[model samples]
Target chain A: MPYFAQLYNFACWLIGDRVAAEDLVQETMLKALRGFSSYQQGTNFRAWIYRILRNTFLTSQTGLKATASLDSEDDALPEPATLETPESILLVRHEQSAIRSALESLPIDFREVILLSDVEEMSYQEISQALGVPMGTVMSRLSRARKAMRGLLTAASEGVKR
Target chain B: MTCDTWRERLDAYIDDSFPPEELNQLEEHLRVCPSCAAEALHRLKLKHATKAAAAARFAPSSEFRSRIAQGMPSRRKRLFGDLWIPGLAVAAAILIALAGSSVWEWHAQRQQALAELVDLHVTTLASVNPVDVISTDRHTVKPWFQGKLPFSFNLPELENSPFRLLGGKLVYFNHAPGAQLLCASGKHQISVFILQGDWKFALSGTFPASAREKGFNIESTRSADLRILLVSDANPGDIHELAELLKAAQQP
Candidate 1:
């Protein structure tokens, strides 16, 4: 159940639509079950499952439009205030929302690398295997993705100052 | 190293991809360069922020789960039904046409041949005897293929390449007798089946293009009238390589 929730969350982040993400995750789970006989146990099940989720999201016809809309809407949103006072819970929520919005604005490949590397804390080798790329490609993508994400956050922070 | 060099190395340093000496130099450069230090700090902070944002997880509604689960099997069954029903019907009609003459006996023989092909496929899969040679070595496997079939079937050395030979088994496909070679690259498995004879069968509008099937990726190509079907879980690019290798192996 915990695994499902984690996968569901990652799916939601990837697709940016809760309903569709859930459907993708469930489909991934079903695939994993059917192909379980072929699965090599004691390996990284999480990466295996995440790879399925990513593929499912990529192939979904409805996903393209939903992700586009989400990306646009996220870009239009304002950054959240970073005030740390206990009474400023709403401000924190706003900030978190803004951060999520910024994340959603990144390109799908960049966003995926960032999510897998930073968010999921997967190693470059694992990320490469899951994404079916070489280790060098994984490292380069992660570097580029982090640079892009940092630029976005910095811009958001600068926007608040302005 | 300059700050620019250190900046580029920063991510690798964090990933620990750098050697110990290079990493030490990177750390030393970061300590001395304020701009690089600030960049590293910003990167670290962003990493944490992104991690926190992703940790804000959400679950899919129960209704959505039920809907997807219900949809997949029906889709698969429908595909299988569409392919096999017409196939069975066509076989039945061919039998009816041949029932009255000596040609009917020939037709019966053809029908029997087709049935035997399907039976061969089922038996190979069912008995776990999918491969005659069970080594990853191309030399060993290729020799096992020698003197086994009438024509020379060249087995490429794919174990050194991306496609590691899993094993080879004799199976029937398209109502023709053939050899099925199973190979894997990483976690993806590819089943390459080579059959005898010169029949060119188009699978269009029959098996959903093999691309639509969720877990399996398949590609079929022919050489010297020998049909090869390569199916795998790898992406199309990698699978196509297998096809090209098979085609190359067939050459002088």
Candidate 2:
């Protein structure tokens, strides 16, 4: 019950369907209850449960399709310094809707890392455990995700002005 | 620091992963570099804005929560829901083949009750005020439960043992009033439930039959009308040792 709302929020974004997200959260709860016995004490229970949800999502039909859609174009990132400009101070201040759209438009892997880090406010260690990735991967994914998000917001703001 | 070096570590700087010395250097650089300053401000604003958007965007409806609660396996109305049955004879035949489904049903129900008790134990562990009386001495914990229950049970001496008497509380287990003695062995919190009821649920034996149920190793025993269940996440062997200690300390 404590993390239900947050779990549902993550589910909605991960699956991108309201009805399916609800079902996914329910399935996750059932699975967690069944496997609660295996959960060790003094470990990050939140990360443990999130890991189960991630594994469940990765195995679902939508998850498989989402995986296939992982674009390789952005794998080669420009130096982060190149993106630093004074214009970003104003560009990043777009409306909440703009931010949401930018977040939704990113690739699922990047979007997930951002959600787990910024929204859920999980530690890099927890994110690593939840995503089954190394801590370095979490940081790099977050860095790239934010960069891509900045580009999307800038483009959206430009479109709105024109 | 060069602009490139400062830029590369900017994300980690914002994340507070840098040591105090490196953070001071980054701060000094940010003060001197206009572009880097603007970038840091933008990232800070973006972080706040994204957190706000996420908080507002995808809240699950109240209906969603109710749907989940209804569908939870533990709260289902029946084990098998609305299966078509040809006749009572067929049902009877199936029950016979399953070695009397009523006994199996009873066992399932008992396990469910144990699961609820385990939930109660964990909840107690999670709560700040786990017990009514707080004391490390058995003398204090034993007397505290005097009027709390309709019955009384002896408390074991926890001295010179790994387990310490933390406290005791009054609780209801399966609608029957019971005294819950809270204990701690090393780092593990243990709940010993003393209820005034028949041992309707079988717990194997009085010699510390340690079996894991609902994430806790439960060591249960019965002496006359008193039924005691010790619940802990500690290893089963340690719990068994505690059980033996309890049996030896019980008054004759």
Best by TM-score: 2
Docking class of 1: incorrect
lDDT of 1 by residue, B56-98 (tens): 4575566655654343332232212222223333445445544
**Candidate 1 runs further than 4 Å off:** A63-95, B16-18, B60-217, B220-252
Q: Which clashing pairs does model 2 show?
A: none
Chain B TM-score list for all models: 0.47, 0.58
For residues A64-150, what per-residue lDDT tens digits would candidate 2 score against the true structure?
567666766355432233554433444445567787887788878888888888888888878877765457667877888888887
TM-score (chain A only) for the predictions, listed in order? 0.77, 0.88
For model 1, residues A48-136, the per-residue Cα lDDT tens digits are 66765665565455444433433321233332232222212212445576567667877676778888887778888778656644576
Task: Report every candidate's CA lDDT.
Answer: 0.59, 0.69
